[model samples]
Target: MEVSMFGGLVLVMVLVVVVVPALLVGLVLWLVSRSTSDDGGAPARAARRHELLVSSVAVLAAVVCTVVLLAQPVAWPGWASAPGVLQAITPFSVALVLCVVRAVGEQTWPRPRGEVRSAPLARRTIWSLGGARLRIVLVTAAALAVALVVFGATADPTGRAFATNPVTLPDGSVVSGASGPYPGWPYGLPMLLGLALAVAATFVALGSITRRPPLHGVPARHDDAVRATSAARLLGAVQLCLGVGLGGALAVGGAAIQSRGQNLLLDELPTHGLVAVGGGVALLGIAVVVASGIAGLLAAWPRAARHAGAPAATGAPA
Candidate 1:
């Protein structure tokens, strides 16, 4: 049964890793070709081309990292019990790479020749570049990370075999409530580090987007629109990472708790509180996982460049 399950999971992973990226690359290529054919001015075409290139590079980097990680013959330390760590960290890694790519892309974006450039009157920061939605997503990710860390710290110290406390029943039998492996410190530590790195990368990327010279010869509003779109995508990636991480953490932790609760019930324990808590956590985790899918879509969805003089949207800076 376990082998069959593992095989099914591998198949699913292959489908996701291979199919999704192919679709995205195809979409990006279509956009690039479409942009090339458009009669837009040189500045507009240049902006579109640069944006599309960055998008393609970022997607490629993520796909490569994911394939390499998944293809490893052996699991990393602590991975046996916390398989969710891979699922969570994969997206985090993608987000981190995306940030780095965006930062570099912004810094190196083409500049108009023989044109005078001026800085914006106000200095821009990550907070200034992104809107309220971005901030909210960041906060949500932080909350989930904190929860994962706290739960991991409290996990039982048993290594390799089981992560939950063993329950002794009336029949002289010992049940380790949950089967081996839980998201203890071994898994949590890696996730925490990844989160920290992702945060730093996001900050740097947003800062670059804000500070980079405006697209040369483009209207200021168009440039602002471009920056805002970039920032949105970056934040969307961050949110997707955190959302997946949190969902995995909750699901694993909850399963452990639920197993313990079931054991207690079997042992005729006094109360069923743990069972309720575990179920709730698991359900919440599932919900989060679903929401993360939406976040991923938002991150990958292409935005058309806003033309000059268009009415300002809700998320764009004034």
Candidate 2:
């Protein structure tokens, strides 16, 4: 299928902006958690089941959402269908983000000696990854919001027409064909930018997670791991962005092919596909954002939970 440059750009945006960062954050936190354990400086095998459970749930939700949205293929759907996706997965996203954040932070930060406060394995692992994850996510959201606004301003507002002209074939058969103004780069550029920002954010987030210990932990040397992860994330983000752009271009080209084959909405297909895919990308973006926010929260959760339940920390000597 031929892909227009514009459509390809959309695909690039999705990859760079949405998926890579989440994976990076997740991996970093998992590593950090594994590196540090109470019994030994190695990750506890016991936490594997719980970690898998959270990750499984998140992936399942994403898959279900993709299927549902694709299957339903909203005709005049409500304002981009984000509200629906968010409502369905917010809880799961929130939980995962929190877990990752706490886990990552605990492992990375320099903890005070003798201040080894015990925390649930799930909490530790999740929060350790969560802090950086949350920041990346917020940035992704802001970027997406800006992209949407730009797309709105530049999108083909006339939209696809329900009724179309019929094409006459040599065999004297008539087929329905729909035509509309080209979906131009103006709309696609914001998406591209959003995707770029998302990718860049992911790379930075990974760096934050792996490069140094968390804000509050015993410092351990993971410089090599940190550098490696950061580099990988950066490269991955760029690849994803390229994918987004390329993917969109292909879809559009596909639409063109289909249109040529028969009277179909070829002109509109690629752009529409990008828009739809963009929503999916946004979902991934949200996951990243949610992860980051929860991490930040996890960094604070232990103290917050304790403070809420116990007496305040006092300046006076005990």
Highest TM-score scorer: 1
lDDT of 2 by residue, 1-318 (tens): 112332343334433434444455456556654564333123212323233334434433433433343333222245432212222222223223333342344243333344432332222222244345434444444544454444334334332212234556677887654322222343244344544454444444444443332222212222222223332333333333233333333333333323433334343222334434434544554454344334432331111012223332111111
lDDT scores in order: 0.63, 0.35
lDDT of 1 by residue, 87-204 (tens): 4466567678778888888867875556454435455666766777468667866877787677766677642122346657688887654432455676677777888888888788
TM-score, prediction 2: 0.34
Task: Give TM per candidate.
Answer: 0.78, 0.34
The segments of candidate 1 whose C-alpha lies over 4 angstroms from its true place after superposition are: 1-40, 77-88, 115-123, 159-180, 302-318
Model 1: lowest-lDDT 10 consecutive positions: 2-11
lDDT of 2 at 234: 30
Q: Each candidate: RMSD to true structure?
A: 4.8, 13.7
Report how far off residue 150 is in candidate 1 (Å).
2.4
Which residue pairs show collisions in model 1?
none
What is the lDDT, from 0 to 100, of the residue 90 in candidate 1?
A: 63
